[model samples]
Target: MCASACYEIGCALGDAPTRGTLALMLAGLLWYVGFIVVASILVSFGAVDSTRRPGYRRRDGKQEGTLMWPSLVMTAVVAASFAASHYSLT
Candidate 1:
């Protein structure tokens, strides 16, 4: 998903944009969107609500200075992508 978002946004805002890059970026965006929609449909129709185990709520589960998993993932994805884009020097 982050890759998808990165492609969709990066291509639009990149320097020396070309038709090929735009097309490729759009294609990547479409592919990711398709993946998500298909997964949603499959889950809604065929997947079961199988909760293996209830979440174990613990004391001190969160820390003030700690980032959540999703936040961490997003940050990593964006940082990696930004680095890749800027470092490419294309």
Candidate 2:
């Protein structure tokens, strides 16, 4: 998803205003980097453990509920960015 957004944004550079394009590019880059840093910190702190225990089955139904919100927020950001880019081109 991020890769696709990056590609679309990159493809628009030639058409969008230089300032807006640069800002969008920088914002997208920062968002991905920030997400990675935050996820690393969470994992390091054991707030988001991914290890499996003995006898744990794939259908145990224990899911990581912490990721949904962040994923939704990220999707919204990407969608908004695309919308902004689209409108800016008009």
Top candidate on TM-score is: 2
Q: Which portions of model 2 show Cα errors greater than 4 Å? A: 16-51, 54-64
lDDT of 2 by residue, 4-83 (tens): 54566567656656786677666765665565566566556444345554443346667554655765676687678657
Q: Quick one: best lDDT, which candidate? A: 2
- How many collisions per candidate? 0, 0
Worst 10 residues of 2 by lDDT: 48-57
Residue 76 lDDT in model 2? 81
Q: In lDDT terms, how accurate is model 1?
A: 0.50
lDDT of 1 by residue, 1-90 (tens): 545555645656465468776566555456545555654654553323232323432355532322244445645655665465444423
Error of 2 at 62 (Å): 5.1
